[model samples]
Target: MDKNAPKIAIVGAGVVGLTVADILQKDLNKANITVIADKFKEDTTSSVAAGIFCPGSSFRGATLEIAHRWIEDSWYYWQDILKTPEASTAGIMELSSYVFSKEDYGVTRNSFIENLVPIYRSVQGEELKICGPDWKYGSYFTTVKIGCDRYLPWVEKRFIAKGGKIVNGKIDSFTDTSLRQYDLVFNCTGLGAKYLCNDSNIFPMRGQVIRVKAPWLKTAFFGDYDTYIIPGLDGVATLGGVRQYDTYNLKVCKHDAAAILDQCSQMLPDLKKVEIVAHKVGLRPHRVPVRVEPELIGGLKVVHCYGHGGNGVMSAPGTALNAVKIGYDFLKTNVKNKI
Candidate 1:
């Protein structure tokens, strides 16, 4: 640690937390950094995400411009990383995906990433036959997927190598620690923030998925009704899911499992025969718009960066970069300057 550097702590171990740590390390080279979290790796909601780069139109920031900036910044951040040798090990990969919908044409369109990604265009008539018949609306686009299973560990290792520290314990409250000890703290604790800040706006959007061996499946597919088959780095592909609103149930529902299999098999009948690897459930920390701002609580400076919903993995870096800028501004605060 640099003796003159400011001491900083980041709370949370998910993609958002790790991304904040990564950016902070780069931006504040001399700062002493430590990541405090009760959960890590597979324990995080990030791992459960299919990690497609498509952000819903509903995903927002404090303002529309801010939202678009976050999305654009995040895309380039991953694109830069994808060009490196560590891309695969970091679980970053270029992916081609097909979005199909029979009811709503808008469901097959994405304004967020349509013009941003490398490729975005209407699917050709023959391309519609790639999945199955009767698909009225369809679009094909090239994007990226970050497998948190690999990304979390990869980032954590890099963080530590760069002189960052990790403390594995749940932070009950920001007031639990001395405010003066660290210059600032970043709150990236996902659903944990609901309790930490008593935020009612944040709720859980429950999701369930099945991981199965399907290396032959190279492209990603999203059918109607939250049904998706996303291929991962390994031969395993994720079949999902159910977005039960305001539901915190982490236990996999048998009914959801059956329904997922039914829907996925309908898209590709061969899925019915794929060996089941595992069934998992996670509660996405959902809010109207993702929270990314600085707050002063009980004399401690903290930046809030949670409520990413299902798009956490895809958007974490962009939001984290913004959060780090806020944290830095708070640390350099003049007594009369207001945040």
Candidate 2:
């Protein structure tokens, strides 16, 4: 490492933090980037997600335009990766999805991604029967899915190739970590932010998923009760889930597994015959504004990019791109910060 090079620290190794490292490394080729996190890859909350590209209405930012920009930018980021031979290795692929509602048509609509993805249209009358006969309203659209089981390692390799470092440890606080010694730090710690920043507004949105070997299922399906069937790069498909707010239980509840299977199988009956692979639970970092800004905490310049709730995996690249922009500006102006 050069004695006077730009030293940057990024907290959290989930998709969000790693994406920050990836983008920053590309943009600031000479900067020293270190990714510190207690958990990695499959152990991360991001791994528990189906890694769908569809952003719910709840996915937000400080402003409407900012939120819109993040989603749009993120789509293109993944699209670029999807075009490469590395797409399969990177766990990035395209898949169409159907969102159905038995009661309200509004549940089937996604304003955030209507125009962003390559395809978004109301489902035909017969298409509703594709999932089940009870579905009253539905929409079909083409989207992307990322398999973090493969993505994390793929991105880490590139980050390391660019001279980035990955460290293993739990970050107790921004001021408490070795990151405080760096010129700039990006706080992408997700739910850990609740304790790391003492933020009362940010809480856990507990979610569960059941992974099953269902190769025949190519399209993703979203039904009521947070139920979804999202296919991955391999033959494995993720079926789930429930968003229990403010819960911290990491243990896999049997009740959740039963409900997820019951609901998912109801939509796609063939799922009942698939081999069960795994059950995953994640505490999504939920925040109202989806924090993505700068703070000078005890003179330690930090740019936060967490609180994507369940959308972190889907939106990491864009939020990370934005966080790097802020972090770069901080690094340029702060000449005396020490590490």
Best by lDDT: 1
Off by over 4 Å in 2: 334-339
Q: TM-scores of all models?
A: 0.97, 0.97
Q: lDDT (CA) for every model shown?
A: 0.90, 0.89
Task: List the pairs of residues colliding in candidate 1.
Answer: none
Clashes of each: 0, 1
Give the lDDT of residue 121 in candidate 1: 95
TM-score of 2: 0.97
Whole-model lDDT, model 1: 0.90
Model 2 worst lDDT run, 10 consecutive residues: 330-339
* Tens digit per residue, CA lDDT, model 1, 46-87: 888889898977898988788888999999999989999999
